[model samples]
Target: MTAVVEQPPAQPKVKAGGGERGLIDLVLRFREAGILGALVVLVAVTTVINPRFLSAQGVEDIFLNASILALLAVGQTLVVVTRNIDLSVGSVVGLVAFVVGDFVSGTQHGVLVAVALGVAIGAACGLVNGLLVSFCGVPALVVTLGTLYVIQGLNHYIAHGEQISAAEVPGAILSLGNGDLLGIPYLPLISVAVMLAVGYYLRSYSSGREFYAIGSSPEAARLAGIPIRRRVLTAYLAAGVLAGLAGTLWLARFGTVVADPARGWELDVVAAVVVGGVAIVGGVGTVYGAALGALLITTIGSVLVVLKINPFWQEAIVGLLLLLAISADRLVALRLARVLRKRNVRHG
Candidate 1:
């Protein structure tokens, strides 16, 4: 009897109840679903308030406007998933846009060169950011903030109070930007392609999964022999490259390129990321969710215009939504914690 009792004690013990863990997983999986539901609700309400909001032309404008922002948000999602931030993305976009404009302004460099230049510039900027954060051990927020200012200043110096006018922009690039496919604009189509590609990588690759591991627990990530610094560097580089791509699109969409286009867009992208269900502290979010958040914000702007509400009220609404998302996340985490505790006590 004594030996049998000792053997029972030697058995492996199960930890937290699966019910709690399962619930948490469900919440995580449904992050994008929740955002989608919210989007549906908002669209339905707006469509009812102003039937014209759903008109074909109105819908086109909304998707077109959201595309650039959605692309930025997708890039931002990658970095945030690794538990980092990139404040300089907007500045990078502005700088790259001006450069691309100057490169092809009066020349026949074509859209391909402009595309390559934008992505290269953005990637270089991201590499710098990643290196500084990874090697120098600087906090991401501080490093990115500094880069933002530096890039913005550099952009002004390069432009020197000059701007790229519509006449200077190449027709091919502009045509590509303005072109549509089967009733869908090019911008949204590009944004969707990028989002789907990145989303697939993050979902399917082991390297991509490491991002979440790092964000969830850096210590554990390190212990598991994951190269935290390299992963982080890659994340920032991807963001910078995407920002560059957006810059190209910006120049194409709005031929009048100025020194400070896309200024102050950092906060907007971050807001979209947060509202899309990506935790600000890191490790939990999908590019899909972020894209949806971007679309939703742009839609809100359109809705406001159609409803004749104060234009400035859109910001207020977005801020409120962000706050609500954070609060909900906190509540869910607390409930999970309580459940784990109860399960432990019961098992004991």
Candidate 2:
């Protein structure tokens, strides 16, 4: 008899679309890694130049300064991922800060009440924006730009040229802004928590994925049965909510609010989002990347100051970085498309 029955040949292991996903994820990680590396190099060089830059106080200052901007950037990510923009966020923040400050200072409202008021005001503003853009089919840029001025006008009228002094702010709110748990500042902690939550939601949820789909191709997503309007509305609502929260935090951190607090901050928020890998064209970006981008921008400002560089150069440097980031993003997207096509053909 034969020594043994012939062994059956093994079938090739199947991986489904694992290779494609892996490649896509690798590209995304590469973008984030590049930003992180830049941040490290910048920090290291600046620290070497000024040892004070690495001191505990200096480090805290960096995180503190970046926290609010990072929060705003995270909110902007939601809207940008949906192929929309919220130019009025700065105005919303300014309005909320002043209103909330005035309300809190004159009344006996606690932190919770002040925060709720801020959120409500923000939601109302967001609702107007969502309705206009989603239902009316208005261009987001034009709609938000209009709202920006409207909100600013309202803020100034309400302010009546008045400002909320530090004495007017509540102790609890100030504590929330400045106090720390263990060794970390509350502001940075809150910013990180919000970033992680939004990042997880966008990465893991089906609805979150739909935002990207709509942004990538509205027609395709619509054909696929996604409620594009609702999703867009939700994104705007979220951005408004976060802007409101940021406004509250702004009050806490600064403890003084003028009619035009955070004026011109919208540009910085957009810049951070763009630099963090969120395409201005939409559909591809992560909250994590956006937060890091905010941190990088904040660090750049600090570095310039520490190195005694001209303040005007900070804007120039940010603009240069923004250009480089956009170029990198476009290149990566093209490479990813090519890879996907090759994989599809090979699989077929």
Candidate 3:
């Protein structure tokens, strides 16, 4: 009589689908893994064709070339994650590089003062950009594009067709750029530090997570009590600061600054961000991925030079890769959605 009622079978647990979860995790990582694989293959082939491609000097050159772009890509990632773009970054870099170089060239300012000035200049630009996009309700593309021309004009007027020469750069600043720690170059070290810091913040903080939320669905984010305007403004400010820092580094690395030093580079930055797995559609990407994408872009150019390929083909190859990346991202997203749907229904 006590056992008259049979016990119902227990519902299956979600942990039962561990295999599916693992697979989903792997799929999520496919973008970074694929880019890494491509990089390894490209480097191997280029090194085989010209062993000097992996030589010490060649390696140094590649890192140096990738550093500034990687830094800019990191900043762009912040903005793009929130469904916005900053076309003015290249102009900001150019202006900062010119102004900082000119200031240091004329004054006895040390490296610290020069860097502080550069960062301040960058902050000012970021504030302007943030105010326009956040408060005025202007589209990011329009706002940044307009600022691009304004910054370029200011740079040209300030330059008056003059350029900063190598001799004008201070020894300490040059050391900061070109010096090494235990045989590791400083430029790459700086870039790595920055990428790590930003990456960590984005991964671990609520405020950072809000960026993706806003990008994924603005209305939902707003309903969740997220401050969309503040987040978006912060993104633009971060981008501006990074661009400024990149400008200072540019001067240090090249020891020469022109009014339009970074012209046409905005396209390259966007391309790298896209190829690095940050969706132009927003709400998907990582700084680490963006940095790798920058490296891949920079490496392709070096590989071409090593293989003695025509320089013109460099841009073409980049475009092809961009298209392929976009297609692959689409496929992955579709597959992920299907898998997630199946998992949800099964578990439910």
Off by over 4 Å in 1: 1-21
Please give, for residues 49-84, the per-residue lDDT of candidate 1 as tens digits. Answer: 888888889988888889999999999999998889
lDDT of 2 by residue, 298-331 (tens): 9999999999999999889888988988898788
Minimum summed lDDT over a 10-residue window in model 2 is located at: 8-17
Ordered list by TM-score, greatest first: 2, 1, 3
Give me the runs in candidate 2 sitting further than 4 Å from their true place. 1-20, 345-348
Question: Which candidate wins on lDDT?
Answer: 2
C-alpha lDDT (0 to 100) for residue 98 of candidate 1: 97
**Could you tell me how far off, in angstroms, the CA of residue 84 lies in candidate 1 after the best superposition?**
1.0
Superposition error at 316 for model 3 (Å) = 1.3
List the pairs of residues colliding in candidate 1.
122-240
How many backbone clashes can be found in candidate 3?
0
Residue 38 alpha-carbon offset, candidate 3, angstroms: 0.9
lDDT of each: 0.88, 0.89, 0.87
Least accurate stretch of 10 residues (summed lDDT) in model 3? 11-20
